[model samples]
Target: MSEFDVVGIGLNATDTLIIVPHFPSYAGKGPFTHEILSPGGQVASAMVTCAKLGLRTKYIGTVGDDERGRIQIESLQGSGINLDHVQQRKGCQNQSAYIIIDQSTGERTVFWQRPDCLRLDPSEIDESMIKSSRLLHIDGHDTPAMEKAARIAREHGIPVTVDVDTIYKGFERVLPYVDYLIASSEFPIQWTHQSDPLKALELIQEEYGIHCAAMTLGAHGTLARVAGKFHYSPAFVVNCVDTTGAGDVFHGGFCYGVLAGWEIQQVLDFSNAMAALNCTAIGARGGIADKEKALALMARADRRVMDEIQRRL
Candidate 1:
C-alpha cells in the first residue's frame, strides 16, 4: 500500500487580495473595500482539498524564508498535509500575487511574481517520495522538476495527474507520463493551436495517450475526453464570492473521484460541485466545502449549462 493517497509537487503562493467596488477601466480609479493575505498555489491548495476530504496528502516544493512563505507553511501545516520534503530557500522571496477582485462579479485580475531563486531543482525531486504516493499531482511551473517527478511516477506505476494553466517550455516532456490532465480552458488552444477546444483535447490525448484529457471551462463547467468519448459537466449555480482556487479544488475533487473509482461523468459532476462551493467565500481556500457539503450541493444546486458546448458534443 502507498504511504499517501496523493503527493503534490509544484507551486505554492501567498496572495494579497484587494477587493474593489468594481474593476477599474483604462485611466479609471476606484476605492478598495478589503485587503487580505492568503495562501494558495495550484498543487498546494489541491493537496489541501485532498486532506480536507480525509485523504492522506503530501506536498513537495520550495519556499522562501520570508513572511509570505511562513504563512504558506503555516497554512499547509494546519491543513494536516505532510511537508517532509518542502525546501526553504534563504533570502529568497516567496511567490506572491496581487489580486484585484471586482466585488460586483467576484472576478479577479492578478499580478504575480515568482523569483527564479525559489525554483525547484530536478535534483530536489526524490524518487522515493514519488514512489510513496498512490497518485502524483503536479503543476506546470519548474517544468524540468515536474518532468522528473512525472517520469518517476510513471516508472513506479503511480498515476500522474496535472493541473496546468500556463504553457511552459518543455511541457511536452511531462505529458507522456500524465495519466489524467485537467487544464485551464485556454491551455488546449494555446498548446495545440487548434482553435477549437474539443479538437485540441483530442489532439493532446492522441499524441500523449493520456487516459483522460480535460479542461475546466470556468462557469461553463468541465469538458473531458475519455476512451474516445466526450463528457461535459455543467458548472453548478452558486452565489460566488471569489473565484480564486476553484480550479485547484476542482482538480482535488477529480482526484478523489478517480481514486474512489467513480465513472467519468460522476467525477466531473462532483468536481464541479466542489468548485462551486469554493466560490462562495473569499480567498483561494476560504470556500473549500467538505465532502458532505459538496454532496449536498451536488444533490440540490442548479447548474449553469452552456448550450454551445453541449452542441459541440
Candidate 2:
C-alpha cells in the first residue's frame, strides 16, 4: 500500500493578510484595519485542506530558510501532513505575498514574490517519493521540476492533478502527463487564444489527450470536460469573507472526490461546497469546513450561475 493518499510537489507561500475597509482606486490610499501573517500557497494549501479532510497527505517542495519558512513548516506539521522531503534553501527568503482584502466585498488584491534561489530543481525529484502516493498534485512553478514529477507519476500510472492559474513558459511539456487539470478561468482562453472557454478546454484536451480538462470560475463555480462531456457546477452562495484560498480548497475537494471515486457531477458539487465554505473566513485556509458542514451547506446553499457561461455551454 502507498504511504500517502495524496502527494503534492509545488509552491508554498507565507502571506501577510491586510484587512482594509475597501479596495482603493489607483493612486488612492485607504486606511487598513490590520494585517496578519499567515501561511498559504497553491499546492501547499490544497494538501493542508486534504489533510484536514482526513486524507493522508505528503508535500514536497522548497522553502527559504527564513522566519516565514519556519512558519510554513510549523503550519504543515500542525496540519498532519508529511514533509520529510521539503527542502529549505539557505540564505533565501521564503515565497511571500501581501494580500489586501476588502472587507466590504471579500475581494482581495495580492502582491507576491518568490525568489529564484528557492527554486526546486528537477534533479531533486525522487521517483521513490512520488511512487509512495496514490495521487499526485502539482503547480506550474519550478516548471521543470513539476514536469519531471508529473511525468514520473504518469509513468507509474498515477493520476496527476494540476492547479494552475496562469500560463507558464514550457508548460506544454507538463500537460501531457497531467490526467486531471483544473485551472483558473483565464488560463484556457489565454492558452488557446480561443475566446470561447468551452472551446479552449476542448482544444487543450484534444491537444494533450488528457483525461479531463477543467477551469474554475471563481464566483460562478467550476466547469469540467470529461469523457467528451461538459459538466457545469454553479457557485454556492455564502457569506463570503475572503476569496483567498477558495480555488485551492476546491482542488482539495475535487481530489477527495476522485479518491472516493465519485461521479463527475458529485465531484463538481462537493468541490463547489468546499470552496464556498472556505470563503467564509479571513485567511486562506480559515474557513475550510468539515465534511458534515460542507454537506449541509451543499444541501441548503443557493447557487448562482453565470448566464453567459451557461449560454455558452
Candidate 3:
C-alpha cells in the first residue's frame, strides 16, 4: 500500500482578510468591518481538506522563517497532515495576500506576493516522496518543481491532479503528465487564448491528451471535458460569508472523489458542494465541512448555473 493517500507539492500562504460593508469605488473610502489573519494556499489548503476527509496526506513545500510563516506552519501542524518534507528558508517571508472582501456579496479582491527566496527548487523534490503516494496534487507556481514532481508521478503510474489559476511559462511540460487539469475559469482562456471556455477546454484536452480537463466557474459552478464529452455541474446555493478558499477546497474535494472512484458527474457535484460550503465561513478553511455535511448539501442544495454555459452545453 502507498504510505500516503495524497501528497501535495506546491504553494502555501498567509492571508489578511479585510472585510468592508461594501467594496468602495476606486479611490473611495469606507469603514472596515473586520480584519482576520488566515492560513491558506493552493496545494496546502487542498491537502488540509483531504486530511479532513480522513485521507493520510503529506505536504511538501517551502516556508519562510518569518512570523507569517510560523503561523502557516502552525496551522498545517494542527491539520493532521504530515509535514516531514517542509522546508524553512532563512530570512524569507512567507507568501502572503491582503484580501479585500465585500460583505455585500461575499466577493473578494486579492493582492498577493511571493518572493523569489521562497521558490522551490526542482532538486528539493525527492523521487521517493512522489513514489510513495497514491495520488499527487500540485499548483502552477515554481514551474520547474511541479514539472519534476509530475514527471516522477507519471513514471510511477500515479495519477496527477493540478490546481492552476494562472499561466506559467513552461506549463506545457507539466500538462502531458497531468491526469486531471482543474483550473480557474480564466486559465483556460489565458493558456489557449480561446475566448470561449468550451473551445478552450477542448483545445487543451485534445493537445495534451489529458484524461479530464475542467475549470471552476466561481459562482456559476464547474465545467469539464472528459473522454471527449462535456459535463457541467451547477454551483450549490448557500449563505456565503466569504469566498476566500472556495477554489482550493473544491480541488481538495475533487481529489477525494477521484481517489474514491466515483463517476465524473458525482465528482463535480461533490466538489461544487464542498466549494459552496466553504463559502459559508470567514476564512479559507473556516467552513471545511465533513464528508457527511458535503453529502447533505449535495442532496438538497439549490443550484445556480450560467445560462450561457448551459446553452453551449
TM per candidate comes to 0.99, 0.98, 0.99
Q: Which lDDT values do the candidates have, in the order given?
A: 0.94, 0.93, 0.95
Tell me the spans in candidate 3 whose CA falls farther than 4 Å from its real position: none
Cα RMSD to the true fold for all candidates: 0.7, 0.8, 0.7
User: Which tens-of-lDDT digit does each residue in 1-313 have in candidate 1?
Assistant: 8999999999999999999989989998989999999999888999999999999999999998999999999999999999999999999999999998888999888899999999998988878988989899999999999999999999999999999998999999999999999999999899999998999999999999999999999999999999999999999999988998899999999989988989999999999999999999999999988899999998999989989998878
Report the lDDT of model 2 for residue 120.
89
lDDT: which candidate is best?
Answer: 3
Clash number for each model = 0, 0, 0
Query: Weakest 10 consecutive residues, lDDT, candidate 1?
Result: 121-130
lDDT of 2 by residue, 154-257 (tens): 88999999999999999999999999999998999999999989999999999999898999998988999999999999999999899998988898998998
Which 10-residue span in candidate 2 carries the lowest summed lDDT? 288-297
Clash pairs for candidate 3: none
Scored by Cα lDDT, where does model 3 land? Answer: 0.95
Error of 3 at 170 (Å): 0.8
lDDT at position 27, candidate 3: 93
